[model samples]
Target chain A: MIQVKDLKRTYVVGKVEVHALRGVSFEVEKGEFLAIMGPSGSGKSTLLHQLGLLDTPTSGEIRIAGVDVIGLSDHEKTIFRLNQLGYVFQEYAILPELTALENVYLPAMMRGERRVYYLKSGIDILETVGLGERLHHLPRELSGGEQQRVAVARALVNKPKILFADEPCANLDTESSRQILELFKKLNKDLEQTIVMVTHEEWHKEYMDRVIYLKDGLIEKM
Target chain B: MFEKFRVSLFLAYKYLTGGNKGITIFTIFILTLVFLQLVLVSAILGGATNRFNELMIDYQTGNVVIEPEEDTEYISDAHRLMSKINALPEVTGVSARIKGVGKIIYEDRSVGATVIGIDPLDENTVTKVNSAIVDGDFISKLDRGEIVLGREISGGYGALMESKSLGGVKVGDRVNLRIGSVDREFRVKGIYTTLFFLVDSSAYINKKDMEDILGVQDEAHEIAIKLNPGEDEEEFRKKLMGIGINEEIRVWREFAGIVELLTRTITQIGNILNLIGLLIAFVIIFIVIYINTINKRRQIGVQKAIGIGSNVIVASFVLQAIFYASFGMFLGFFAMQYLITPYTVTHPIQLPIGPVILSLSNTEALFRAALLFFATILASFIPAYKVAREDLLKLIWD
Candidate 1:
C-alpha cells in the first residue's frame, strides 16, 4: 500500500548542511504493522515525516495508495492528508482548549461529513481506545495516557488508510507507554489497521509484523 | 465559502468565550477608548458650529430676514409689510428695524458702531436680546431717550475687542450718538453681552427715535421674522413671494459667512485629528492582535495540520477583530448619546464662545464606525496570515 524510492532530506543549520536522509528506499504491504528503528540522528523520524507528507524531501519519490503525493498542490495535499492519512505526534498534540470528543471529531468535521455521523464515529473510536469515560475532558484534565489515547482516536476517526506515529510515547511513563503499544497491537491484529510507527525501544519490535533499521540516513537492516 | 465561514465563526466564538477573559475584556476596553477618541473631536467641533448658528439666530437674525429690494435704501411701507407677515399662522414674531452707521461718544473716547432702532416690545418677541441684559433693565418701549449698549460698544464686561470700544461706558451714563447730520444724547439704560463679537458691536434705541433721526417715516432697512419650531424657512420665503411681496428675503444661514469660515477651519483640524485617532487605533489593535496570534502560533499550526485551511484560521482572527470593533463602537455610541451628551445638556462645557453641548450626527458616527471596522480587519488579518502561512514543522515544533 506504500512505496518509497531514494527519498532524501537535508537541512542547513547556520552555514553547514546536514543530510538527514540519504538515498533511503522502502515499501510496506497492506495491513502490516511496521516499526522504524534507529539510533539518534539516524533518519528514522525524517523518513516517517516524508512518508506522512508532513514535510517535503529535498529529492525523491513517494507514493501511498498509488497517488504521487509529492506532485500534488498544497491544497490538494491537505485534502489528501485529511481523507487518506493520519498522524500522531510525539507530544500527543491534541488542542488544549478542545474537549476530547471535540478533538477527535475535528478532522471528520473538516471532511464535510454530517455532524451526527462524525460524532458517532468519534465516540466509537474513543471507546475503542479505552477513553470512553474521558470524552468530555479537556487535554489538561486528562492524564498523559488518556491524552495520548485521544490523539489515537483522532487519528482513527477519518478511517485513514495509513496511520503514522512519530515517537507517540516519547513523553509517557513506562506503564502508559505499554498500554498505548498494546492498543496499537490489538488494532493491527483485530481491525487489520496498517500503521507505521517510529521508536527507539528495542522491546517495541515484538509487536511489529516487520522491522526496519536505519543508520546514518540509509537503510541498514530489514 | 459558506462552510469555511461557518468554521471560522465557530473557532472565533470558541476562542473569544473560552480564551483568557482578562485579555479579551482589556482589548475591548481599549477599542472602546479608541472609538471615543475617533469621534469626540468631531462632535465637539459640531457643537461649536451649532452654538455659532444658535447665537446668530437668537441675537442677530431671527430665523428669516427681509431686507430692502436691490438698488433701494429701504423696504417701503414697512408697517403694512410687518402686519402682512404677522398674519401668517407660521409667523411667531416680526420686528422692523432702521439701521444707520454712526459713532458713540462717552467721556473722551468715540467708537464707530451700527445704530439700530427697534420696537422694544416687538424685538423681545423676535430675539432674546431682552433676556441678555447683564448690567441693568432693558429699555422700555415708552422710554424715549433711553438706550442699550452691547459690551463691545460699552467696553467693560469681558469684551474681546476692548481697545476698539468706547473705553468704559457705564449704565445710566449719558452717551452722544452721531448719525450722519443727526446727533442725539442718550442715557445708557442697560449693557448686554452675547459673547458674539460681531453682534455685540451694535447699539439699540426706540424705533420712533431712529425714524426721527433718519427722517424716514413708515420705512425700515430690514425686518426680522421668527417662526415656530420646524417651520421651513425657504418654504416661508416662497410663501411670501407668492403673496406679491417683492423684496430680498434670506434665511439666517446666508448671514453666517464669517461663522461658516470659522467652522470650516475647525472642521479641517477635526479631520486631521480623526485621521491621527484612526492611525493610533490601527497601531494599538495591530499590536494587541499580533501578540495574541503570535502566542497561538502552535495552535494555528495544529489546526492547519488537521486540515483546517490557512484561510479559515486567518478568517477566524478577522472575525474576532470585527466583533471587538462592533462591541466597542456600540458601547461608545451608547455612552455618548445617553450619558455624556445628557450630562452636557445639564452642565454645559464653558467655551469662550458660550456654553457648548456635544453634537453627534448619526451620519458622521456611522462613517467613523465604518472606518474603524476597516482598521480592525486589516490589523488582525496581517498577523494571522503571517503566522498561518509559515512552515508547518516549524509551527508545530518551534
Candidate 2:
C-alpha cells in the first residue's frame, strides 16, 4: 500500500522553474498492478520516482506500508529501499562485470544473508524468470530480452513488498515487451505482487488492474 | 563492517580480474617504473656516499688517527706509542706520520703541498697509497733523498688541478721542498694517485729525512691506525683510552667534515627527486582512477539505486589501487635487489670518486614503499569519493 499527499517537484533550468509534478495525490492498495500514463512532461515518471524513494520531492508526504519514507535519512532510505522496494530500470541496469546470478543476489548480499541462502534464492528467482540457463551469463553476453529478464529476477530476489518499473520494456522489441507484460500479468494474478509501472503504450492498460492518467503535473483522470 | 569490507573486496577482485586487461597492465607498469625511479636515486646517492667514505678511510685517514695532545707540537715517544698500539691484536697496522704544509718547487714552478714523513713498510700496512703508484716505484727506507709525489703535486698523468701543481715533475726528477727554515732537494721516486683530490695533493718521504729536517727525533705529528676486518672504530677508540694512551684519538668520520657536506647535499637532491617521483605517481594514479570512475558513473548509480552503499563503491576502488601499488612495489624491489643491484656489484660503475655500486638499504626501501602506499590510497580516494557522492539521478541519467 502507498499514500502520496500534495506531491510536487520543480526543476530550475537557468533561472526558469519547470513544474514536473504539481499538487499530485494518489494511493495504491496492496497486491494491485497499477499503471501511471501520460504524455511527455506530464509528471508520470516523477510521481513514480517520488513513490519509489529514488528521488526527493520538492514538497510531498509519501508513506509506504505506513512508514514515512519522505522523512527518512539518506542512509535509512537506502536500507529501506533494499528491504521493502525493488526497481526495474529501462536500460536493464545490471552490473556488466557481474554474472546474472551475481547481479540478482546483490541486494540479498547487501542484506547480509547467508551465502547458501542468497545463492539458492538467486537461482530460484532466475529460474522463475525463465533465465535458469543464463544464470552465469554477463549482461553484455545476454540478449536485450534476456537482460531485461535478468533485471526482473534481480528486483524480485529481495522479496520487496512493492516493485517499481519505470519504462522497463522501453528498449525491448515488441515480442520481448509482450513477454514482460505477460510476466507482470501472471505475477499480479497468481502471486499478488504489487507493481506500479510507468508506460506510454495504450495497449498496456489491458494487463493492469488499474490505470491513472496524469496531465500537466496533475491527475487528469483515474 | 565486516560485511561491507567483504562486498568491497569482492567487487574489487571482480573488477580487476574481469575488467579491461589493457588498463590494468598499463597502471601496474607505470607504477612499477615510478617505484623504480624513486629507489634508484637513493641507491646511487648511497653508493656515492659509501665510495666517498671508503676513499677517506683507505687513502687518507686510516680508520683511526691519534694526533698530538693539545699544547704539544708533536706526540713524544711516538715509536713507543706505536709499539703499544701495535701490541693490540685488533691493530693490524700502525704508521706514525710527521706532517707539514710546505711548498714544492720544480723548474721555476712552485705549489703548496702536504709533506708527510712515513716508514714505507709501516705506511704500506696502514694505507693502500703505496699500491696506487701510477708510475715508477714507492720510496724505500734507505733512499733518504727520494720521495713519492702524488699525481696532484707532481702534475701530469691526468691530474685534476694540473696548473696548480709542480710543472710536470716525473720520477728521478729533482724537486726542492721548503719546510719552515729547512730547504732540501729530493728525487721524485714515484707518482701516485688516490683519485681523491684532497688526499692526492700530499707527498710522502722517509721518516728519517723529516726527523732530520724538523729536529724532532722519535716524535711525530700523528699516528694512523688500521684495524682488522669487522672492527668498530668507536669501540677501538675506547680500547685505546683503556690502555693508558693519553692522546687525541679520533675515528675517521670526525675528520670527514667535507665529505659529510658533500654527501648531505647529494642526499637533499635525492630527497627532492624522490618527492617529485612520488608526486608523479600520485597524479598518474589519480588520473587513471578518475577516468575509470567517470566511465563507471552509470554503474555506480545503478549500484546505489539497487542499495549498494557509497562507502562500498569507494572502498572497492581503493582496494583496487592498493593491489596495483603492491604489485608494482614488489616487482620494483625484486628487480633492484636481485637484478639491478647485483649487476652493479659484479661490474661496478666507474665514477669520478671511485668504482661505485648501487647500495639500497632495507630501511630506505621500506620507507619509500610506505610513502607510495599512502600516496596510492590518497590518489584513489579523491576521485572515487567525488564520483560516489554524486546525486543518483545525475549519475544515472546525466
Candidate 3:
C-alpha cells in the first residue's frame, strides 16, 4: 500500500543543515497494523508525514497505491492525502468549534465531497467508532477518549486506504489510551485498513500486528 | 463550493458566538472604528447648511440691486420698475426703494446714516430680511419713529450684539431720521435687526417717508428682485442685465464669491475628509484582517496539512474580509445618519467644519462618499492577497 525509494529529507535550522532522513527506503503491504517505534531524533513523525504525503522528501520518491506522491501538485497531494491517508495526531486535530459530526465530516468537506455521501459515510464511521450517539457534542464537551474517537471517525470518513495515527494516545491517561488503542485495533481488524502508527509506548505493542523500530532514520524490522 | 462555504460559515458563526474570543473581540473593535468615522462625516455636512441658510437670507437676497443711471435720479415708473427683469422665469418678486445718505442725530449723539424708505409689504415679499428681524417686529407698523438697527450699532450702546437691536429703547420710541440734504422725521413703532453692520447704520421706513425726505414723487433709487428656483439664474440675469436703465441687474450668485467660494471650499473639504476617513477605515480594516490572518497561521498550517488546499484557505480569508467590509459599511452608514446627522443639523458652527457644510447639497456628495467607502474596502484586497499567499512552512515552524 505504501513504498519509499531511498527517501532523503533535510532541514535548515538557523543556517545549519540537519539531515532528518538519509537515504531511507521501506515498504508496507495493505491491511497491515504497523507501529513505528523510535526514541527522540529518530525522525519517526517526519517519516510518517512523508509516507502520508504531508511532507515531501528531498530525494527519491514515495509511491502510494502506485502513484508517486512527491510529484503531485499541492492540490493533488491534498486530495491524495484526503482519499488515501487519514491522520490522527497526538493532540486531536478535531476543531474545537465543530461538533463531533462536523469534525468527522470536515475532512470530506475539505476534499469537496458530496454532502449526502459524506454525511452517510460520516455516520457509519462514527457508529463504528462507537461515537454515533455523541455526534452532536463538541470536542470540548466530549471525554478525551471520545474526542480521539471522533478524530478517528474524521480520518476514516473519506474511506482512506491507510490511516497514519501519530502518537494519538500520547496525551491520554492509561485507561483512555488503552481504550483508544483497543478501538484502533478493532477498526484495523474489522475494516482491514493499512494503518502505520508512530508511537514509543512499549505497552501499545500488544495491540499491533507487527512493529517497525526506527533508529537513525533506518527502519529495522522487529 | 456552496456547501464548503456554508460549512466554513457555520464554523465561523459558531466560533464567533461560542468562545472564539479573538475573532469576536476583533470584529467588535473594527465595528467601532468604522462607526466613529461615519459619524464624524455626517455631523460636519449637516451643521454647515444650517449656518449658510441663515447667513444668505440676511446678507444677500432679492439679490438684484438696481442703481440709478449716471443722469437719472430715481426710477419713475413703479409699473416698469422690474417689469423687464420679472419677465424672466427666475423672477419671483420685486421690491423698490429710495435710499438717501445722511446723518442721524439723537439728543446726545450723531451718527452718519443712509435713510432707506421701502414699501413695507413689497420688501417683505421679495427678500427674507424679515426673517432676521430679532427685535420688536418686521416693519408691521410704519409710523415715523419705527426703525431697525444691526448688532454693530447695538454694540455701540452696550447692547447685545446679537440678532436684535432697539438702540436701548422699547418698541415705541422716537428715531430721528434725516436725509443728507433734507431732514425727515419718522416715528419708531418697532425695532428690527438689519443683520449687516453697514445696513444697521441705515434706518428702514416706508416709501412715503422717503418720498417726503428725497422729495421725489413715485420713484425709487434701487429695485430689488428675488429669483425663483430652477431658473438658469445667470443667463436670466445676463438677458435682462445690461438693460439696466442707468443701472445694472445683478444676480446674488455673481458677486457672491465669498459665499460661493466658502461653499465650494466647504464641499471640497468635506469630500477630502470623507475620503480620508474612508481611507483610514479601510487601512484599519486591512490591518486588522491582516493581523487576524497572521494569528491564524497555525490554523492555516493545520488546514493545509489536512489537505485543505492553499487556494481554498486563501479564498476563505478573502470571503471573510468581504464579510467584514459589508457589515462595517452598513453599521457605519446607520450610525452616521442617526448619531451624527442630528448633531450637525443643530450645531452649524463646530469650528473646523465650514468646508464640509457646502458639500451637503452637492449632487454627487452622497454617492462619492459611498464610493470612497467601498473603494477603501476594495483596497483591503491587497493585504488579504498577501496574507493568503504566505509561506506555509514559515507558518508551521514559526
Candidate 4:
C-alpha cells in the first residue's frame, strides 16, 4: 500500500520557479496495477518519482506500507529502496559493462545476499522473464525489448514490495510493447506483483487495473 | 565491512576487464613508464654522487687521515706513531707521507706542484696509488734518482691550466724539482692517472728521499689510515685520540667536505625529482579517473538508484587506482632489480670522477613505491568523491 498527502515538487531553473507537482494526492492498495497517463510536462513522471522515493517532495508526506518515509536519512532511504522497491527507467537502465545475469544480481549483491543464492535467484528470475538464453549477453547485444525484459528481471530479483516503471515501453515497437504489457499483466495476476507505471499510450489499459490521468501537474480524471 | 569490500572489488574487476582491452593495457603502460621515471631518475642522480664519494675514499683519502699539529710543518716522532697505529687491531694499513710544495722545471717549462713522499711498499697498502699507474713502474727502494709524475703535471703547466695535454714531457723524462732552495734532478719513472684533477696534477717520491731533500728528518706531514671492513672511522679517530696522539685526526667525510656538500645537494635534487615524479603521477591518475567517472555518470546514477551506496562506488574507483599503481610499480621494481641494476654494474658510465652505476637499495625502492601508491589513491579519491556526491536525479536526467 502507498499513500501521498498533498505531495508537491518544485524546481528552480535559471531564476525561474517551475512547479512540477502542485499539491497532488493519491493512493493505491497492495497488489494493484496502476498506470498514470498524461501529456508531455504534465508531471506524471515527477509524481511517480516522488512516490517511488527516488526524489524528495517539496513539502508533503509519503507513507509506504504504513511507514512514514519522508524523514529517513539518505542511507536509510537507500536501504529502504533496496529492500522494499524496484525501478525500471524509460531507457532500459541496465549497466552496459555487466552481463544480463550481472545486471540482475547487482541489487542482490548490494543487499549482501550470498553468492550462491544470488546467482540462483538471478537465473530463476531471468528464466521467468523468458531471458534465460540471454543471461550471458550484454545490454548492447540485446534488442530494446530484450533489454527491457532484463531490466524487469533485475527489478524482481530482490523481491521488492512494489515496482515503479516510468514509460517502460516508450522505446519499443507496438508488438514488443504488447509483449511487455502482457508480461506485466501475467506478473500482476499470477505473482500478485504490485506495479505503478507511467505511460502516454492509451491501449495499455487492458493490463492496468486502474488508470489516472493528469493535466498540468494536477489530477484531471481517474 | 567485508561484504562491502567484496562488492567494491567485484565491481572494480568487472569494470576494469569488461572495458576495452586496448585502453586498459595502454593505461597500465603509461603507469609503468611513470613509475620507471620515478625510480631511474633518482637512482641515476644518486649513482653519480655515490661514485664521487667512492673515488674520494678509495683514491684520495683513506677512511681516516692524521695531519701534523697546528703551527708544525711536520709531525714529530712520526715512526713511533706509525708503529703504534699499525699495531691497533682495527687498523688495516697505515702509510706515512711527507708533503711539500715544490717548483718543477722541464727545459724552460716551470710549474708549482705538491710533491708527496711515500714509503712505496706501505703506500700501496693504504691507497690505490700503485693500481692507478698508467705508464712505467711504481717506485722501489733500490731506485734513488727516480720520480713518478701525475698525468697533468707531466703534461706541463699549460696542460694543468687547460685540463688538456700539452705533450711537453713523458714517462722516463728527466725533471728538476726545487723545494725551499733545494734543487734536485730526477728521472720520471711513471705517469699515473686517477681521473681526479687534483690528484692527477700532484707528484710522488720516496719518503726517505723526500725527508733527506727537505732536511726534515724523522718526521711526516700526514699519515693515512685504512680500516678493515665495517670498522667505524669516527670510533677509530677517537681511539687514536684516546691513545694520546697529539695530531689532528679526521675521517674521510671530514677531509672531503666539498664532495660531501655536493653529495647532499645531489640528494636534495633527487628529492625534488621524486616530488615532481609524484606530482606527474597524481595528475595523470586524476585526469584519467575523472574522465572515466564522467563517462560512467549515468551508470553510477543507476547504481545509486538501485541502492548501491556512494561509498561503494568511490571505493571501486580507488581500488582501480591502487591496481594501476601496484602493478606498474611491481614491473618497475622487477626491471630495476633484475635488469637495470645488474647491467649498469657490468657497464658503468664513465664519469669524470669514476665509473657510475645505478644505486638503489631495496628499502629505498619500497619506500618510493609506497609513496607513489598513496599519491595515486589520493589522486583518484578527489574525482571519485566529486562524482559520487552528485545528486542521483541530476546525474541520471542531466
Please give, for residues A21-120, the per-residue lDDT of candidate 1 as tens digits: 9998889998999999999999999899888877899999999999888998888878888889888889878877788998899888877788899899
Candidate 3 residues lying further than 4 Å off, grouped into runs, are A113-117, B1-4, B20-30, B54-59, B62-94, B97-117, B134-149, B152-257, B267-297, B314-332, B335-398
Q: Tell me what TM-score chain B of candidate 3 gets against the true chain B.
A: 0.65
**Cα-lDDT of candidate 2:** 0.91
- lDDT, candidate 1, at B193: 87
| Ten contiguous residues with the weakest lDDT in model 2 chain B | B1-10
Q: Give the root-mean-square deviation of each candidate in angstroms.
A: 2.0, 2.1, 6.2, 3.5
Docking level for model 2: medium
Error of 4 at A156 (Å): 2.6
DockQ for model 2 equals 0.78
Candidate 3 docking classification:
acceptable
TM-scores of all candidate predictions against the true structure: 0.95, 0.95, 0.74, 0.88
Interface DockQ of each model: 0.59, 0.78, 0.40, 0.72
Q: What TM-score does chain A of each model score against the native chain A?
A: 0.98, 0.98, 0.95, 0.98
State in Å the error of residue A125, model 3: 2.4
Give one digit per residue, the lDDT tens place, for model 2 in A1-222: 999899999989999999999998889999999999999989988898888888999998899999999999999988888889999998989888999999999889888998999999999999888999998998999999999989888888999989899998899998999989998888777788999999999988999989999999999999
Q: What does candidate 3's lDDT look like per residue over A34-146, in tens digits?
A: 99998988888888878887777888778889988899987788778767888888777677767899878877877677879778878888998898899889888999888
**Better-scoring candidate (lDDT), 2 or 3:** 2
lDDT of 3 by residue, B107-155 (tens): 5545565667777777776766566565666565355445655434433
The CA lDDT of each predicted structure is: 0.90, 0.91, 0.68, 0.86
Instruction: Rank all candidate structures by their lDDT, best first, as comma-separated numbers.
Output: 2, 1, 4, 3
